[model samples]
Target chain A: MATILKVEGLWKNFGGLTAVSDYFLELPEGEIYGLIGPNGAGKTTVFNLISGVLKPSKGRILFQGIDITWFRPDQIAALGLTRTFQNLRLFPSLTVEMNLRIAYHTHARSGFLAALLSTPSFFREEKEIGQKVDRILELFEMSDFREEIASSLPYGWQRKLDIARALVCEPQVLLLDEPSAGMNTKEAEDLAVLIRRIHEEFRLTMMVVEHRMPFVMGLASRIQVLDYGSVIAFGTPEEIRNNQKVIEAYLGVGDLIA
Target chain B: MKQGIRAEWYFLLGGLLLFGGAFLATQFLNRYLLYILVLMGIYSIATVSLNLTNGYAGLFSLGHAAFMAIGAYTSTLLTFPLALREAYELPMLPAFLGGPNFVWPFFPAICMGGVLASVAALLIGAPVLRLRGHYLSVASLGFVVIVTTLAKTMKGLTRGPMGISAIPSYTNIYWTYLWLLITVYVIWRIVNSRFGRAMMALREDETAAQVLGVYPMKYKLMSFVVGAFFAGVAGGLYAHFTKAIRPFEFSFFLTFQIVVMLILGGMGTTAGPIVGAVSLLTLRYALKPLEEHLKIYGLIEIIYAVLLIVVMLFKPEGLVGQKRGVKKITVGGKSSA
Candidate 1:
């Protein structure tokens, strides 16, 4: 598979504290890559840097072989790189449908003047956006909550809506920040199945920043373990499971064989 | 089905009530009451327009009064041939502006004023809308100060601190209500549209808004310009109603009064600004005698400031906030219990 995203020599610092240090990764197109780390391991920070939320102090990020290190968040999003926040950042006042509609704004061609005049083309585009929103909501099984305000949705549904919104952007590479952080075991299992289904259905490349061992091991074809803002291990799940260093990192033992 | 009575219907009904009340007051009340009502109606437009920015879009702009000044001066200069005759000692204004004897009708002049103000807003909003939060507030405040200074300094055009007087008294209760209805309709339609949804989205989370393809700068400028247009219409009516125009009339205090009305009623709600304007104006008129007796220059200001502080402390969401409707769900032949 062709590489969809490439990050090399990435460094981000927050006033003498290195958040992500010399991080390097290559994500193949249409693959689910898992990023695992303990708390404060810079996994989410790496996602932030790649998604253009935080600028890297020193690095090169290429999306589809085009350098996007300096692109703004919106610009990067327009180039089909979208991410969900660790803490849900849904628009509370807007309905679930409206929240998803916002992601289609890039696809909308109507200007303010056109909308004011109620032009036929504007109406057509609006109808198209409505249909697109319906499709995404149905895909996530969130159609019943379409008119409900995002904040009013239950916790699991809120996470589903967030991912649904990100999907509306039609991104090539989706960065999910802890997709099942707050779910129960059953919900986590369901999410794992859903993630695999979504990756296949959308033909998407995904980098999931997660700490849940079961979910990551079950879902990810390849795993990259981050320690102290650096990639300590990169291998398949079986190889990673057998790595002595990986075992020590998780179990805090110097001599452990899996 | 009963929930079909959307918020827009409330706005329309409320506007009708205001119109009916304005008409009734004109028939039974004295000229002073009529004057106050007219002023209230005009200020209501400004307050409502300001709410579109400060309330719905979550932008705080202190320079709205500058747009009012622009409309007032533009209409005054265009219509008041007396100024052309006295200040420039010329018989007429430009031919396109109807010249010396060209007295365009009041409605068109008001519209012209609104258009002019919108144009000015577009110019200023382009650069100012780039600044967010406190920066936007400071930039807009600076704009107001600049416009006020220009009005005072440009003596030949604006008649300086003396102001322009002898404007035609063409605005009456009927015309005021008509304009108010139009303003209310325009604002109501805007807030219910997709653009309004995007604006609220921007207010909630700008980064998410941008990622979703809602350009914050463009929408912010659009709201600013539209809001300025209505504010200009209000200014035009004020100019014609008083048969006089002055720079100080659209001062920082005027901006503050409008802001108070918006906050008091509820910022984002369509009825909030109108409710705020009518309530505060009535209270001010009622307290005028007491204010004179106490020798306080701005008794209303003290009241307004205190009210704002109290409201911010206890009910920062205001009287009418953006509330979500509850939904009932059913699953497996029973309510999801």
Candidate 2:
């Protein structure tokens, strides 16, 4: 498989503390790679570095063989890499339909004059965006909540909406931070299926960060285990299940590792 | 899609009714009432543009009055009759400028005012827009101080403490109303477009917007420039309407008043500033007779302060955008919820 993202010896620091250190990764195209770690193991920090939220003190990142070390977060996203936050980031006062339209603002092909004049092409393009929003809402089972304000939704639905917002951008690569963090078993299972379906349907490469062992273990074809701001082990799900270091990191140095 | 089309029709019909009503009223109203209406028109442009930057795009700026000052000076200098420039002993200017020998027509001069103010906004926003929240506010406030001080010190251009007058009073009912209509249309178009969405996204959350591929710096600066241009245009209108220009006219009080207008009306909605401006201007007129008897200055400002406090206490979202304070709407006894 061709590599879509290559991170070489990335490290990020804040003051005297090192949040993410000596992290290296390769996320291939058309694969769902998982990064599983204990709490404060720098999984999300690694995601932040990859997404350009935090500049790396050392090393570089290349997306599609182009060095993107100095790119802004928006510039990175414009190149078809998009991300979702661990905490929900919906436009609270805006309606769900408006939220989706706003998310697709970057991908819109029309200009200011086109919008101002409401020209024939503008109307055509707007109709297409509306159709796309409708289809995505339907797929996400959020069509009923389209007109409702985003903040008024139940928590579970908001999580789905966050993922839905990211999906609307049609990114080539997606970085989802803890997609199933607050879900129940059934919801998590549903999310697993949904993530798999979206991965295949959108032809996207994904790097999902999660602390839930079962969630990432079940969803990702390959998993990388992180501990103390560095990768401890990386392998398939079967290998990760039996890895001593992974078990020790998760359950501590007890009889379980033995 | 159908709903969007309906909204557009409603906006068009509403605009026609408003403009037509105002036009008819202007023909018959007394001079004082017409003056008050003109003030509202000018302020509507300023307040609405301020709303674009401070409300939708979420950049808190206190320097808009400074941009207005620059516009007032630029427009006044360009359109101030050449004969009067010589009589008033106006300072020498570059040949490209008035140069005490030439003056452009009102339209071109006013446009130049807006363009110059936009350039100033670009220069200021490029550096200061990088700062967020209160830092941005402070930097912009400093910008206002600079403009005000320059107006005081630059005796050649601004005439120092003695105000510049004999400016052609071209701002009749027609021009003010026309410019008001144009400002509303232009701002409304932008606020409803995809670019507007990108701006509001930044307002709500910058990090989220950045992650979504909305460039915060680019959109913030765009909002600032467009907003400043409209403000400058309004300042041109004010200069001609009042037939005078002074450094102290565009002071902190003016900034506070426009900010109050936006906050009282509602920020995101285009109609909010108009309603706010009209209401506040009318309130000032109503209090006009009491000002002489009270023998205190800025009694209207005191009234505005009390009113703003009351509104802020009762309705934090402003007047027009209150959705749930009453819980239900009733025509008579029947409740519509």
Best by lDDT: 2
How well is each residue in B1-337 modelled by candidate 1, as lDDT tens digits? 1122354467678778877887789789999988898888888889988988888788899888998888887777777656345654323567777666676677788889899989988998889888899999899988888888898889877878778788777888878878888787777656655677778889889877766666688788878988999989988888888887777878888898888889888888878898889988998999899999999978867988998999888877676765453434322221111
User: What value does the lDDT take at residue A101 in candidate 1?
Assistant: 80
TM-score, each model?
0.85, 0.94
TM-score of 2: 0.94
Ten residues in sequence with the least summed lDDT for candidate 1 chain A: A113-122
lDDT of 1 by residue, A152-204 (tens): 77777778888888888899999998988677779878888888988999998
lDDT at B234, model 2: 93
TM-score of chain A of each: 0.96, 0.96
lDDT of 2 by residue, A178-211 (tens): 8876677798889888988888888889988876
Q: What is the Å distance of residue B191 in model 1 from its true position? A: 2.8
Pairs with backbone N, CA or C atoms under 3 Å apart (clashes), candidate 1: none
Instruction: Kindly provide the TM-score obtained by chain B of candidate 1 when compared with the true chain B.
Output: 0.88
TM-score of chain A of 2: 0.96
